[model samples]
Target chain A: MRRSIVNDPDDLVAEALEGLVLSHPTMLELDAEHRYISRKQKARDKVGLVSGGGSGHEPLHSGFVGTGMLDVAVSGAVFASPTALQVLAGTKAADAGRGVVQIVKNYTGDVLNFRIAGEISGDDAIDTEIVLVDDDLASDTGEDDGPGRRGTAATVIVEKICGAAAENGMDLQQVAAVGRTVAQRSRTMSLALAAGTHPGDDEPQFTLDADEVEFGVGIHGERAQRRIPFTGADELIEQLVDPLLEELELGRGTEVLAIVNGLGSAYPLELSLAARALHRRLDTDGITVGRSLVGSYVTSLDMHGVSITLMPLEDELRELWDAPVRTPALTW
Target chain B: MRRSIVNDPDDLVAEALEGLVLSHPTMLELDAEHRYISRKQKARDKVGLVSGGGSGHEPLHSGFVGTGMLDVAVSGAVFASPTALQVLAGTKAADAGRGVVQIVKNYTGDVLNFRIAGEISGDDAIDTEIVLVDDDLASDTGEDDGPGRRGTAATVIVEKICGAAAENGMDLQQVAAVGRTVAQRSRTMSLALAAGTHPGDDEPQFTLDADEVEFGVGIHGERAQRRIPFTGADELIEQLVDPLLEELELGRGTEVLAIVNGLGSAYPLELSLAARALHRRLDTDGITVGRSLVGSYVTSLDMHGVSITLMPLEDELRELWDAPVRTPALTW
Candidate 1:
């Protein structure tokens, strides 16, 4: 329960910025009217990578903004979307002679904010492209004339590959195209064994049975489709893999990038074991795993359980993934 | 509460071996007779890097025994030491025509077993050298005979650097020398906000009051020097930093590597924040941090807390750290 902080919530952002600077002084943190982090001024002719969502996912947006990844990360309050102005500030900070590509997860507010920001930052010289990531199939697809459920974890994988594509000197349009392709080709399913309590909240955001686990849960602890009895890990992984494979059309001979991400409180051993099991199931389906990453890449605070993300990799996507890129979250 | 087992203590090791191979078919698990994983009999003339310790710290002794880091890792059961026979088996599995360098953490049983294994393996036409890591500053270093206290989290950093060095074509003796120097320069201190619980055990290995925490704790939940009131993270980090700096004799312009390692259960956000705090303290002391890694490199089951390791790095250690290596735990 002990935390390092100044007095109130208003100062939370500034205090946290100070801590980040203290921890990673070499990594640039711009403490200006509109805060953003960058290693250097935006590069001309190189595609600009921008990503933003909520602030609670530390080292997610901001920590990931660096040389081979995001040029700027616009951070909002805990689980809250940044205002359009904040997004615009980040875009402006990251904009060089080349255009900027915004990697926005498909949260309703996030989409709206980034879209408005893009319009506001429109310039003849500065083109802006927003790639919406809605890889979570558990979110209602909204039958017709509606966007899919808000994007969650897969945004990270898309950003990583897109960042690499951009770093390899791809133009903004090309980078955005790669980003969209990666997002469309990826699918994620998460389960929650416990809810995460807000920093100041005494009680958990929600409740769950000690023995029951909610599958396909949201990053914000939203109610899942169903709470099922706790069973063996292999069964849980099988349930996750089945939905993901079906969604991504993965079968024998399909090359995949398997991700077994921890939702915070799950043990590493459990996550690795679940990843191992998930890989086996994918193998049984004759799916060829080109690259596999097993860790807590995108986490939901300290919630217990795990998520499986299957990225059916094409040749272009696999090459983009293998490119040398540096980010705090996805370091290879 | 759910676990798989064969119900015989003696059979536990064999069952675990089969489970490991079955769990990870992608990984070439060494068989029972020769527990070594290799690409083929004639893999390469690469300087073989090996690391081993107690088994409870999963993904450490096995997960990291792939391409880049350690060629082989001998795993002991739970927190117990791996037998010399197992070490010899792993050595044989990793012998790719070049010499083998053994990385032994400063635990008594592990050091003893690895030393005996090296002696035995050397007799079989393989040139082998052993590097003993005695980096835990909290241990009873006053004893001149050798390193006392458990070699907790710092072992991961040593393994990474040495593995990187080996990957850079360093001979077995050279890798061992670099590892030894790094170990002497490194010091670590850990804290536990909650005690670790062994699987199937009713209670934790130990206990802590609601407002108390164990400072300078061993990774295995062994008793620490003292139990004190739970102070805020800054004060606690200050306590850890002072001891580490004093022990390492860090001065202005001294380059050091910082490792803020989670002992399992601590969330990634918390670890990131702690790393930020530790970095700030080091900056104030005018120390230059060469490389900083924050993750659960070596864990003690589900212990909830973190350990900080500071290694005063010179040019050689820094060069070795940057050497390109591939392993499951570290890839850069």
Candidate 2:
């Protein structure tokens, strides 16, 4: 298992941090622990948005840390969630005396860690608001009384709009309400024809036959619900839309912000086709898609598949969506 | 070949054009015969900049046809250059009522076609200037003359900075001069571990042994200078950098803008490591890198290789590079 950096496992995070800092020196200011990379100037009189997760998804949590997006991004080891201390440090760094909002995807590990971080943050005068992203409702959230699998790609869009709202002088609680509304409105489902290899590991996390693909896979190589036959892209998208449409009950005159995200290894051509299929299907279903994006916004390493997330638009939500944001992960 | 669209060879361009207009209703306004997608709003008397090339590189010509980069992008067929008619129409669409400058990569087909377009455009009241991108030093450019092969990916950076400059109100002549200066000062070389296949095409344009990589391959699968033994990224960077340094005469106190572009299929991780190697080698050689980028900015389908481009920066050149232009292909 050969990786690019220092031989020591402990040094990997620090070295990667150094590299990230060098690349985005102007936009990012990192503290000594390498725990958090925040915007140089905190948002004065505005709710600070903080997001983080595993380290492998470059430009995801960290790349998104800059103007118009996350105030601070905490880092964990590859495919691992950040600790409470790390998240707390990030929250503290991003706090501008105006409350802090944590965008946590619904992975049990992420939810628990961020919750603890929030508890620790409560000691300060600032308030802490947590918006859990459980847009992927493939499985029961209450299964075994455990936390649901976190699918937070849409959290990026939500954070951007909500961040824009905060940037435009919205109060903390109001901005947070908008964020929660977006998270509730968005839903995503993913499929992978091949799994991504963990760094330093040659073999992929999982494998599939050339003609077969896994449906509803997680970023960490979790298996999906069904193994269906390989067919045209239309069928693949139908599998996704059928379930999603049922959940959203989207109908005529319902405008949606459509996102077709590659899980990694998926080519732009495929992504475009998938986006087109989803768009075509939505149109057939009499759903009005206000905005559609086809690209690798939220990837799962080099997993080969696509995830479609639809965010139903309301007045406030649409305004936030249209607001300007300056983040490395996503840019208008 | 299994292309994505359903149309005749002649109508393929129109179909694709319709798709682009449909997909990006806001950013682009196309003149199909003339291959132009202009910003919907009229320009503010700034220098009008236009760039286009073979059509296979999606989002390159069209995706980049927005606010900060190019004002006009004229696309040809898949891996083919556009006709003079297309180029002229594109010029008309992008002309902003100010003198228009065309940023062309110096391929025989592109040079000839764009030159014809410029000549036709010149006959009109519009002032037309041409900045040919002859940056690829790896291939001989002359029938019996100087330099090497046709212009490759470095054209993107030249287009980006020049577009930025033009948008910042640099006159047509000034923008053309900047484009020409960067094109001359810049040099690019590429190596391919695998050849790319056209959409729906199973066979690759070229092939390499599993353990070998072809160095200095062209965008259309042209043969490279060598196929060396497979090695680690550091060794590969050394191979890429040694040539680039010699070509550019980069040394201590020299500021350079480094672009590590994926020819497709190459993942971001590999690109990152390669950028790391490039930075280290440049630093070891006493060269000061002002900025660095690693991504698939200008790709060749899904070919698996990377190209390294270096532009020696001067005060005026830096200013032009810093200018803010709007286009889809290049952004700040």
Candidate 3:
């Protein structure tokens, strides 16, 4: 049996937003009624950035809001997309004179709601563009007709690079192009030793035996397509990296930005181990890891897992990644 | 059953250090043979700072080793203190021309080894001071003797303040004094929904009934002094705050720096809720929360819990706290 440190499951998202805004009062402000968070001081004459979805994957959309990241972030209930009206409020808030760019994760509900919000924003004379991110290598099916790969940790790379471009006074279309470029090139694969439980639920989303591991998992507490043997950290990371490397077609002398992200319950210790293994493996294959982030940025509600994301580093993307950002979860 | 993403429990610490050093190669360096981490570029004409204990509470001693924090952080195995020889190596490494200050937790083994190391370092004509941190209000016995209180999340505050002072070129005694002031004024209390498991352990340190919470818990996965009925976030915060308020003798018009720290498996959302509750409760008492941090800086493997630490702010201490820091776990 599992328990949560929450009062009411329904109030978790709103309360968390209030708490987060309160924690970073100088850098963030909240529109509580609209259920959105915006920058403490609105930017002017620059393309604004907005991206949000379900609430469970925190520090993702909300935690990414700040000076050099998202201008606005809206929240829906846990694991549920925000309403069209809510997204519209966020997009409107993100609008400076130049226009706004909405970085949407490639989920059906999220994509639909963001599209609707973008269309509605046109009535207010605000130009908007959507950059759909779908980088999960595990969700890649052979058929192009399917929903395509679900977005995962690569969203951070997208929002970060796009945020930097927009901050540098790029037009809406240019920022969208940069975001799309990052999304298209990045690929991620994840594995979980255990699944997460909902806030008030008594049981976990799924169960695994002591000797079994759930391989190729996603961020929304979904089961993996295959189960792999419980093994050493080096071997597990090898399994996740091999497919990504093949999919990215990363050849010798390729330089890439990497992320060893924890899916909620994986601690710094585990992420460090994975990062070390990744660096070793990439060096062996003559792929230089140019820049990397290792932590739980996009999480799955306490799921005990980790994801590896890789994007071939471009000079522009590297500059954007190095740009200063001050947010509640990430800052440099 | 609980399983960790670690192989060969004995190799976990060393491997983790190697991985951490590799991850932040620009800011940190590792002495694998001696099990200590130091700054990539050593500081000159500054008092050196060092802190370390067991390995499980990551991002603690090791993660805080960087430009504005500890000059060196030594590590032992899980829940074990580094040996005197290892600590001597770290102390000697931290010493530049100015001298060194060792920020130690108030644990028997840690205090003993750091003391021995400090004495040994004196033979090299290196002056050293020890700042013992004992901030856990939960373990306060109110006796003239007794082990007093175990240091908890307040170590971060202590390390951060001392690091800033040392960076400003304070003498060894002055730097140690600043750390002691922060440690003395700060107090922390913690409760756990569930205990953390060791790397290869199949069970948690302790079990809590469905409707009970382990209150007054420590960082080593030890049992709490008492069990309290499960309650809402607000009431739990009230229970924790009432005692701290009383203990610190905080008045209605006082200002303080607060930390809402995650013990381990507590996710971002849960911590935000805790932070929200803490802010509301303190505001009601008219206490101005001058500064606050909410995240998992120090952890106990994967224990699902949160800790609250408050130190009444002083102008000099506040300036030091706001000083720029660049470490793996903390940088602003």
Candidate 4:
């Protein structure tokens, strides 16, 4: 087997949390029993921001727990939802009498558990609002019965805006409202050149031929519905960006914040090329990229892919995004 | 051929720089002509910091240009040193009359070019000091005649410490001294599971069997001195740590700042596990980790590997490290 640097696959998440907390001792504290990471010094009398999901997306829910960001983040096994009990504890830990806003990605298990936790937290007089992020344009079937578009990299924007709003002492409703606005306005598209292997498994979840790439892939290692010819950087990034521009209904002179996100193993060089292509494409269409982030924030194990997230930047969203943040993954 | 999302390898570095500068317009400004990135707003009357190397190790010289870090960063092709003229241009760009401290990794080409540039910059009345970083324990041959250990991960610590010292109004000499001390005290060890393929190359630089790993590897995609049985995370980490402890001559109660760096394709889960193993091993050694960083700060071009950097933290060094830094790749 292509060995992973792990003891047992079961112990990976817990040990990782241990290391994360150890590395950021002053900024974070972990409750290993409940599988949640919370800020070391809890903020008081402010709306609490909480987010989480499967464990493989490192620096997402967990790395976001700090000042001016997530107050608590619950995690589960790789690509699996956190248990309702875990989410409940996380939600409770997030409350400090000002209510908690739950920012959850659009995934069935995550949705169910987060909703259950929000409902259960009500018994403690802790009000919670669920801001569901459904930004993945690739999964946008527009069908009412199906699971809606899966959330992708836009979760970073939602978390950042909500965290800033909460840190600004906005009430629960205001924080949740802004977060939902970000979620509603954002759209993302992803493509994978290579699938990631499970920790102990020898084979990748899927394989692509030398001349083809899996387009419209999600973060869970699932294959996309279609394959496209593998081509140059500009062409590939164009494929990802065209759909986002259309889905967002972006018009000429529109301004947006862009995120060129690296899916697990998309290194800095690849991400840089993708970012350049995206900016050039948008500029040609008379759209302005007002703000941007390029990195591997939201990931899917070692999947060699990238996703572009775009959200039309309103004045308030721009200011909120500009607000100071102090988190492991994103600090400024 | 293995498909890379690149249009032409010849234009890759320049385009990536364009993308990087575009993404961080407020913090960075690029001189496309000379191929160096400098701070958007120059800091005056303070010792300037300039560094650069090959292009593949992203977020190195380029991403570190900002308020409290590098003032200028030059670039070259992937895994190739920037030319003397590029270094000269970068040095001139960094000067704001307080002199410049050039942090050069200990590679033949990098060393030769940086020195030539530093010497030539004297004509422009820009005094420069070279803080040579050579911390790779794997390449340590214990002979004075050899080129010395190749600098790897410790360059980050050196750059960070020197930047803080310079920001604190230390003169060029003082900044260089502090930075050199960090480089002197620090040691790094790296290992690769799989070699990285270049952008347009079909094959990797090398390959390892499923049950073997290249121990004592460097940032370049070169083979290690020995191959060892592929083992679990704790054991592999133990192997890396053993040599460091011996080389550093650590005692039971000493404190150190550790950096668990990913060399390209090592993902967060793998890095987290490596960090956990390092902390546990150090704890068993009765050594207190004073401060630590865990991420892909220094990397090969998508090489699947990890490197550990250890430096005994002095009170002065600790304070400098704790100083605020604002750069794209590193900020606190």
TM-score of each: 0.89, 0.89, 0.99, 0.98
lDDT of 1 by residue, B175-289 (tens): 7887878777788898887766664453568777767878888877778888767765666777788989887778898888888887876765567557667877787988877
lDDT for predicted candidate 4 compared with the true structure: 0.91
User: What is every candidate's C-alpha DockQ against the true complex, given to 2 decimals?
Assistant: 0.26, 0.25, 0.84, 0.75
TM-score of chain A of each: 0.93, 0.93, 0.98, 0.99
Q: Which residue segments of model 2 deviate by more than 4 Å?
A: A1-14, A123-126, A140-146, A232-235, B1-23, B32-35, B44-47, B96-99, B122-127, B140-147, B168-171, B203-210
lDDT of 3 by residue, A47-75 (tens): 99999999888889999998788999999
Number of the candidate with higher DockQ, 1 or 4? 4
CAPRI-style class, candidate 2: acceptable
Q: Model 1: residues >4 Å from true position, as ranges?
A: A1-33, A123-125, A144-147, A200-203, B1-47, B66-68, B96-98, B144-147, B164-172, B199-204
lDDT of 3 by residue, B211-319 (tens): 9989999999777789999998888878888899999999989999999999889999999999999999999999988999999988999999899999999799999
TM-score of chain B of 4: 0.98
lDDT agreement of model 2 with the native: 0.73
> Each candidate's lDDT (Cα)?
0.72, 0.73, 0.91, 0.91
Q: Quick one: ranking by DockQ, best first?
A: 3, 4, 1, 2
Better of 3 and 4 by lDDT: 3
Looking at the true structure's interface, with contacts defined as alpha carbon pairs within 8 Å between chains A and B, what fraction does model 2 recover? 0.05
Q: What is the lDDT of residue A221 in candidate 3?
A: 80
